[model samples]
Target: MASSLTKDSVHPGTPGTEKTFFGHPRGLATLFMTEMWERFSYYGMRALLPLYLVAPGGLHLTAGTATAIYSVYLSLVYLLTLPGGWVADRLLGPRKTVTVAGLIIMLGHLCLALPAAASFYVGLVLVAVGSGLLKANISTMVGHLYNGPKDARRDGGFTLFYIGINLGAFVAPLVIGTIGENVNWHFGFALAALGMALGLAQYLLGGRHLSEQSAVVPTPMTAQEKATTLRKGLIWLAIAVVFYGLVGFTGHFTLNWALIPLTLIGLIVPILVISRILRDKDLDGEERSKVRAYIWFFVAAAVFWMIYDQGGSTLSLFADASAKNTIFGWNFPVSWYQSVNPVMIMALAPVFAWLWLWLNRSGREPSTIVKFSSGLVLVGASFFLFLAPLSIAQDGHKAAAMWLVGIYFFQTVGELTLSPVGLSVTTKMAPKKYASQMMGVWFLAVTAGDSITALLSNPAIGGVNLDKMGFVALESVLAVLAGVAVWMYRGKVNKLMGDVR
Candidate 1:
C-alpha cells in the first residue's frame, strides 16, 4: 500500500527539503508517533482477546469459538482494506480518513471498556472498520513525505517508521497485557483507548508538518461512476439482508454458520480477481506471464500467514494453558509472550535488511521465489520445534517458556524473509493499469489464509483436535505442503517471472 508522489503531487514544505527529524522530514516524526500509538492500541487489544474470551471473568467461551471469532475478525480487517483504500482515493483523502479512523477506533475501545456483551461485539466491529480505514492510508501519507519513489531516503524512512510500529507492539503487551491479566480487563481496554487518543491528538497537532497533497483525492469518482457504485453497493446490501433473513427464518442462524460467508469470500475473491487480471485483453503476454508468476507467490504467502498468524490464537492459548510462564523465579502473565515477536522484529529487521543488501552487492542474493520458499520452509520447521517440548513434560507439567521463544524467533526470521519481499514483488509484477488492484489482491492472501485458519481451528468444522498429538499431525501436514510447493513450482515460477528477479 505504498505510494509514490510526483513533484506536483507532493507539498513543497514537507518533502526531502525538510531535514528536521534525523535528516528526514519532520513529518516522519509526526507519522512515526501516530502509527506507533495506533499499533499500540491494536496489539494491546489483540494480546488480550483470545485469553479474555475464555477467561471466567470474561466471556468464558470455548477455545474453538474464540479462535473462530479471532480469525473472522482478522479476515474482515484485511478484506475491508480494499474498500478503505477506495474511500481514500474517491472521497476523503488520507489525512481526513486517518483522523476519522482514529476517532472511530478510540470509540471502539471505549465500547469494549463498557461492561455489556452487546458493547463487546459492537466494539470489535468498530475497531475492525477503523483499522481497515487507517492501515494503508497512513502508510500512503508517509510515502508522500518523500520526494518520489526513487528517493534514496525513502527506504530508510520507512525502516524508521517500521521501528515505530514494533516499538508500540513490543511495549503494548507489557503495559496493557499486565494490567488486563492482573487488573480489570475493562481497565486495559480503557488504556488502549487512551493510546489512540494520544495518537489522534499528536496527529492533529502536527498536521502542519504533513504534505497538503495528502488531503487531495488522487482520483475523485465521476458522477456517473459514483451512481453506478452506489447502485452496486445497495444491491449487495440487499442480497446480504435477504441471506441473513433466510438463515434466521430457517433457525440455522448461528455464529459458526454466520462466519461461513466471510470464509467463502476470502477463498473466492482472489481466484476471481486473478482470473480477471489474466483475462484482461489490455495486458500483453509479458504482463500476463508476470501475473501468472504472482499467483504462485500469492498462494505461498497465504500458506505462510496461515501458520504464522496462529501466534495470536492457537499459540496464545498454548501459552496460557500449557507453557510455563516463569523466568528468573517470577511468574509472568501469558500475554507477555505476545510481545516477543515484535521485539524480535525490532532486533532482526536491520540485520535482515543488511543481509539482503550485502548479498545483492556480492551478486548472491536469491530470487524472490527462492526467498519466499525459504520463508515457508523456515516457518514450517518452526512448528516442528513444538514437538520436542510436547514429547516431554508428562503429568500435566507445562513446557518451558524458552520453547515458545525459540518458535517466535524462527517465525520472525521467516517473516523478514517473505513479507516485505512479497509486497515489493506484488508491485513489480502488477500490470500498470491494475497496480492498486493487485495490492488489494496481495491483502487477499492474508484474508484467505485467515479464513482457512478459522475453519481449521473450529473443531466442529475441520475437527482439528487441540491436543499435542493433534497439533503435531496438523503441523506435519502443513509443513509437507510447504515442501511440496517448493518442489513443484520453483522452476516454473522463475521462468514465468520473466526478468523480475
Candidate 2:
C-alpha cells in the first residue's frame, strides 16, 4: 500500500512510509492541531459577535444591523482567501503565509479585547484579513500531504482533519461563549486571542513534521512581476477608498445600503473568477471539463452554506430571543447553542469516514455530485424543523431547545456530506498551476452564500422579514434549486469529473 504512494507523499523525511498518526502521515497530527486551535479562536469569537452587538454594554445595534455586519464580515473572511491563496502560490508559500496570518489573527483578537467601538470595528477588519490569508493556504498544505489523485486515504484524511476543526469549534462556544455571555465580552475575546497564540506556538514547534513542499513557492513571481502586482493592488485600493468616500458624502451610506453593493460584488466576483479560470490558456481539455463541472458543485455548495451558515446569526437570534434554554430545569447561555453543530460533527464524522471507505471498497461509492445533492437536501430540510417550534410557541412563549437541536442535527449531517468533501474534491479537480488559487475559489462559494444570507437577513433593504412563513419560503426555494441542479445536470457533471470519483 505504501509503495503505491507518490514520491512526494506526506513529508519529505518519511514520504509514504510514515503512518504515525492513526494510519496516516505524522505531519497530519501537527497540521490537525494547528487548525484545531485556529478554529477555536475563530468560532470562539464568532459565537459572541452577534450577541455582543446587541448587548447593552456592547454595540447595542438592532438585529438587522448586527446580522448584516456579521454576514458581511464572514463574507469578506472567505472572499479575501482568493488573494491570500495567490500570495501563497506566488510569493511567501503556505508555511510562511500561514504563520504570519496567525499572528495577525492574534493581534485582531487582542484588539477586540479592548472596550472601544472603534477598536471593535478595527478588530473585525484585522481578523477578516488575517483569516482570509490563513484559511485556504492551510487547507492547501493538507492537500500537499497526499500522493497524486489516486491516494485512497485522501478523503478520510481530510475527514480526520475536519474533526480537528470541529474539536476546536465544539469546545469554543462552551468556553468562550460561557465567559462572554456570563462574565465579560472583552474577556471572552481575550481568551480567543490566547487560543490563536497557542495555535501559532504549537505550529512553529511542529514545523519540522510538515511537507517541505509547503515551504516552496509553486510559482514564484519575478521581481518585475511583484512590482507590477503591488502597483495594481495599490491603485485598486485607492479607487475603492475614493468610491466609498463619495458614497458617504452623498448621504446614502447607510449600513443596509452599503451591504447591497457588497452583496452584488460577492455575486459578481465568483463569475469573473470562474470565467478567468475557464479561459486560462494553460488548461487542457480534461482540466477545462473538470472546472466546468466544478461550477455546478460550486453552486450547490453555495446553496448549502447559505442555509447552513445561518446558525451563527439568524438561529442564534432565535435561541436568544425565543428558545427556552432550560434542559432538565437548568438554564444555559444561548451562545452554547453554537456548540451543538460541532458536537454533532465530532460524533458523526468517523461514522461517515467509515461509510465512505466501505462503500468505496465495494465499488459502490457515490459520486461527488450525489454527495453534494444529499447535503443540499439535508441542510435545506433543517430549516423546516423550525416550523414545528414556531407552530407550538405562541403569545411570545419560548420554544423547547430540542427543536433547535433537531435542526442542528440535520444540518450537521448535511455538512459532513458536503463541506469536507468539497475540500477534498477541490484539491482533486484543481488545475495543476492554479492549485492553491482553486482552494480560494472554493471558498468564494461560501463568500457568495454568506453575501446572499446578509442581504436576506436585513429587512430594511427589501430582505426577508424572517417571519414564520417568510423563513419557510426562503429555504424552500433554495431546496428546490438544489433539486433542479441534480435533476438536470447530475449525469453531465459526473462525466465531466473524469476520473475524480
Candidate 3:
C-alpha cells in the first residue's frame, strides 16, 4: 500500500523553492503558520456569526433566520472549492492560490467592518470565494512536500495542518467572538481581516519555505488554458454579479436565495466529469474501486458535517436559548460554549494519532469504512444524548452549560474517528489526475451538509422549529443512514480498500 511506504520528507518555501527540515522542508513552518492564521480568521468569524446576527446590537435576527444565513454561507464556501482546486491544480498552484485567497479574505474583512447591511453581505461572499481558493490547495501542497506518495510523515503533516485550523479556532472566539458579543459587532469582523492580512504577509515574506507544488505543470496551447480559465472566471463573475444585484434589490442580505441553486449546479456538473476521469485506461482496477468508494466517502462525510457544523449554527442558538452554562457558580456567555469542540480536538488530536498507529500495528484499528460508520453512529448518539436534556430544557429555561460541553465532547470524539480519517481517505482513494478534484468533491459534501444544516437552523423554514426540528431530525436521519450504510456496504467498503489496511 502507498501508505506502507515511508522515508524522510521535504517542504517547499516557494513554488520552485525546496529545503529540508528534519528530513522535511523548512517551508512547512511557513505554510503551517499561514494556515493557522487563516483558520483563525475563518473560525473566529464563524464562532461569532450566529451570535452577531441574532444579538440585539447586531442584526437582531431570530435564531432560525440566522442559521439559514450561516447554512448558505457554509454551502457556498465549499461549493466554491470546486473552482478553487481546479484553478490551483491547473493554473495558479497552491502557493499563489493561498496568497490570492488571503488578500481577498482580508478585503472582505475590511468591508465587514462597516455597519451597512451591504457591507456585511458583501464581506461574507468574498470570504466564501477566498476560502474556496485556499482550503484544499494548501493541504495538497503539504502532500507535495514528500518526494514519494508513501511518505510516513503525510499523516503528521495533515495533523499539523489540522492543528493550525484549531489553533485559529481556539483563540478567535475568545477575542473576536467576545468583542463581537460585547462591542461593535463589526469590530470583531475587522479583527478577522487583520488576522488574514498578517497571514498573507508572513507567507510572502518567507517564500523559501514553499515546495515545488506551485510550478506550472507543463500544458499545451496557452490559449486553451486562457480560454478554460476565462470561461470559469466569467461564470463565477456572473454568479457574483447576479447574487449581489439581489442584495441591492431586496434591502436584505439574501444571497443564499440565489447561491443555493447555483452551488447545486456546480456540485452536480463535477460528479459527472469526475466519473469520466476515473475511467481512463491508464488507471488500475484497484484504484478505480477506491475512487468509486470515494463517492460513498463524500456522501458519508455529508452526514458527518451535518452534525459537525452545528457548532456554528444550531448549537450556537441552543447555547443562547437553552444551555445551562455555569462554572463554579459563574455564568458564561453562550457563545463561549462554541469554543469547546476545538479545544477538545486540539488536546485529543495527538492522542488519536498515536492511537491509530498503535491499533494499526496491533491489527486492531477498524477499516476506514468501519471507522466512518462508527463515527456516524457516535455523532448520532451524541445528538440522542443531547435530546434527553433538550426535552427537559423546554419552556425557554437555560439548560446547564454541561449540556453544551457534553455535546462537543462526543462530537469531537466522532470527528476524531471520521473527519481526519476521511481526509486521508481522499488522497488514498483517488487517481492522481482527480485527487484535487475529489478532495474538492469531498468538501462539496461538507458544503452540502453545512448548507442543509444552515437551512434547518432557519426558524421560519416552512414553519419548522429549527431547534426542535434540527436536533431531532439530525439525530434520527444520521442514525438511520449510518446503520443502513454499515449494514449494506459492510463488505464492499472493505473490499474496495485493497491493501490500504
Best of the candidates, TM-score: 2
The global C-alpha lDDT for each of the candidates, from Candidate 1 onward, is: 0.79, 0.86, 0.72
lDDT against true structure, model 2: 0.86
Clash statistics: count for each candidate: 0, 0, 23
Candidate 1 per-residue lDDT over residues 1-501, each given as its tens digit: 111221232334555343355546777778888988999999999999999999999999888878888888888777766667668878787789899999999999999999888899899989989988887677667767776544545545565677678889999999999999999898999999999999899889878878777788877889999999999999999998998899889998887776777777878877887898799999999999999988888888888888888888878887887778999979999999989999998898777666766687788978777788788888887778867666655457888999989988888888887876775666567676653446567777888888988877676576452436566557656854775686477888888988777
Displacement of the residue 75 alpha carbon in candidate 3, Å: 1.3
- The list of candidate 1 runs beyond 4 A from truth reads 1-16, 20-28, 142-158, 206-216, 245-252, 281-286, 393-395, 465-467, 470-473, 480-491
Q: Candidate 1 at 274: error in angstroms?
A: 2.7
Best by lDDT: 2
Q: Which of the predicted structures, 2 or 3, would earn the higher TM-score when compared with the native?
A: 2
Give, for candidate 2, the lowest lDDT window spanning 10 residues. 1-10
Clashing pairs in 2: none
lDDT tens string, model 3, 1-501?
111222344443223333343334556667767887888788888888888888888888777667777877888888878777777777776678778999999998888889987888899999999999887777776666654445555555566557667877888888888788777688889999989988888788866656655544422237777898689989999988997888778887554555446445544654665677677887788788877766776777777887777767777787777776679997766667767877888899878777776776787967677778877877787777677557767755667777768878988888887777776767667677665666677788777676666555444445244557455756656665775687479687667767664
Q: Between candidates 1 and 2, name the one with more favorable TM-score.
A: 2
- Tell me how candidate 1 scores on lDDT: 0.79
